[model samples]
Target: MIEIDALTKVYGQAQAPAVDEVSLRVPAGSVFGFLGPNGAGKTTTIKMLAGLLTPTSGEVRLGGFDVARQRPAAMAQFGAVLEGSRNVYWSLSAWQNLMYFGRLKGLRKARVAERARDLLTGLGLWDRRDDKVGGFSRGMQQKVAIAAALIADPPIVLLDEPTLGLDVEATRTVKNWITEQSRELGTTVLLTTHQLDVAQELCDRVAVMRRGRLVADLPTRELLAGFRERDRYEIRVEGTVPPGFEAVTREGVTTISVRVSDPGEVYEVVARLRAHGAVLESLTQVQPDLEDVFLALVNEPSHAA
Candidate 1:
């Protein structure tokens, strides 16, 4: 459980805040995506939540403990893997890294050992547990860092770009692990990433930010459905496309996509194509995805201060 209230962060003498009155409530055991393009203050917000940075105004609470006032108790509620930073000791073995972090969390040696075995095995690093993390591949190093983060068995996790540079297989492995943690272990996840498809697939809810302000926040399916309600269609024809229409040709067929304000306009498009002696192949409704929604939101004129 995470709660943010009117969180604001202004740097130095900058006229505008990096994060402005951003508020959110992330439910327990849910995967929530915090999305935005570069310089949208996503990392700034996450840092404040992780206590790595203090907010200029407003508050953050973790599991009902105010992050600023109850730093130790609030920190006990979550583990974090920050972006563009090494979360684990490079010279330490994977097992050693976990053991060290677990002990730091006040876990007993025996308990830490047990958790290390399970986490390393689950992450496919058991065989290399004794190898120095500096010698491991980037993906393996990332896995070690994640294991260390989870070594404490905290109820919540803050992951920023957890899959940034991994290969397809490594990315899938991490995604599956995140899913399992939320579904089976009841772990709350606050994820921030540039990968829209990954967020669309894994996030239960999503919030988009622009110019340090919250633009859209909703359940992923509901957001997609809202865009799907628009009247858009894709038509494939076997002959020449008439004027006033843009077409893409593949093989011998031309595809034209159009959006109409009224459903009756679709029939008019069909009639026009027929008038040009074009043989209709197939017609289907166009579906909008997360990328489309993201671009539309981020490109809009900013009204925030």
Candidate 2:
């Protein structure tokens, strides 16, 4: 649904580009995550693809329409909530905001009312649909903004920090809604957020950026699995342990840590410990998670921005 090739953005006469020769592809009906720290060019890349900013070089295509060359066609292919509640009007009610944006997106007038009704009801804002947006809470306004973005029922959704500051319930609501978009509705999603857990949950594939460069891109599972320290293990034992797996005694219990080169070595180590009179209490393999993977990748000296 989305394709970017050699995309770059540079300030006038700057030594380094804000987005440097970045390229990526997002398959139809898939959720793609964009992750990076401050000044890593995530926003710049999104803006370029959304046609909010002109790229210095290269191309951005959405749903097969060249974003720069075919502006209207590209515009019609996606809906966006890049700035959260700011996308909606303060004076407009939820229903009114949807109608206005529906018109702006060139959606048919008849479809606008139908889509607005469905979106408002789906987002739990039907009861408050008539109330002015300025009177709503941030979370409510955000829901309304998201509703407006989907009012046209575009094929692709570009969301930046879709669930940034909402409370637990509200965040869950948005997360489920994004999931529903790809599953039931077959809509493609391009998501960017600082929340690693959210990305881990919703993204099918993710790309990491550093200093405007695309550093990593892979399926969510593969990316996390790649960061796992497979051979690391923690063992609780009594008596004695093998030479390399030296036991440390604390609180009348002996604990040892070992990092083997291969998985089969774990069994060999266990056999050696048993032969050496070690009495094992527990053996636990260290598990890796998204937070650990994200921190390790982002903090890696070469990937740091």
Candidate 3:
């Protein structure tokens, strides 16, 4: 749904570009996560793609329309929730905010009102729809912000840390709604977030950025598998140490860790320990997660901005 090629951006006369030659693609009906540390240019890239900031050099195309060439048409293809959820009028009611954006999207008065109510209710803001946004809490304002984004029901949604500052319940609500939007509505989501857990849970694929460059792009599972540290085992025993396996004791000698290549090696090690009159308690396998891969890629000294 979106394609960015050789995208570069610089602010004023900065020594280095905020976004440097970053290219990305978001396929239709898929969720793509943009990962980076603070000031790594994730927001700059998103802004270029959203046509909010013009690129110094490079091309940004949204749904086949060149973002710089056809700004209006390109923007019409995307809905973005960027930093600061104050995009809506503070004095306007929640429903009023949605209605305003709906009209801005060129919807008729009746259609705008109907869609605003549906979206507000879906986001659990219908009960408070009449309250002024200036009086609503941050989480409530975020819900209304999301409603405003969906007012036009654009095919692509760019969410920058949608659940950044919410409580567990509010985060859950937003996550579930985003999932529903992707699954049932087939909305293509391109999100930039520092929350690795949220990215792991929601993104089909993730691209990690550093120093204004695209460092790694991989499927969440494949990335995790690549970071697997041989496979770890937990053994419980009381007697002597195993012969072939190197064991590290923890938890008051009730637990030990053994790193092995395969389960058969684990079994062999367990048998060796049992030969010394050690009782076997339980065994478990460890798998690497997105955090492991993210750290591995982003911690490189060469990636410094």
Top-TM-score candidate index: 1
- What TM-score would every model get versus the actual structure? 0.96, 0.87, 0.89
Expressed as tens digits, the lDDT of each residue in 1-305 for candidate 3 is: 88999999989999999999987788887888999888888988988888889899999988999999998898788888887647789999998888889989888999989888899888888888899999988888888888898898899998889998989999999899889988899899987887889999999888999879988877778777777776787777665665555565666465677887776787777777888777777776667678877887888765331
User: What CA RMSD would you report for each candidate?
Assistant: 1.7, 3.4, 3.0
Which residues of candidate 2, in runs, are more than 4 Å off? 235-257, 262-282, 301-305
Per-model C-alpha lDDT, please? 0.92, 0.89, 0.84
Cα deviation at 50, candidate 1, in Å, is 0.4
lDDT of 2 by residue, 1-305 (tens): 89999999998999999999999999999999998888889999999999989999999999999998999998889899985338899898998899999999887888999999999999999999999999998888889988988988899999899898889999999999999999899999999999989999999998988889987888899888887788899888888666765568887788888899998989888888889988889988887776787677777866522
Candidate achieving higher lDDT, 1 or 3: 1
Model 2: which residue pairs collide? none
lDDT of 1 by residue, 140-254 (tens): 9888888988998999899889999999999999999999999999999999999999999999999999989998889999878876846889999998989889789999999
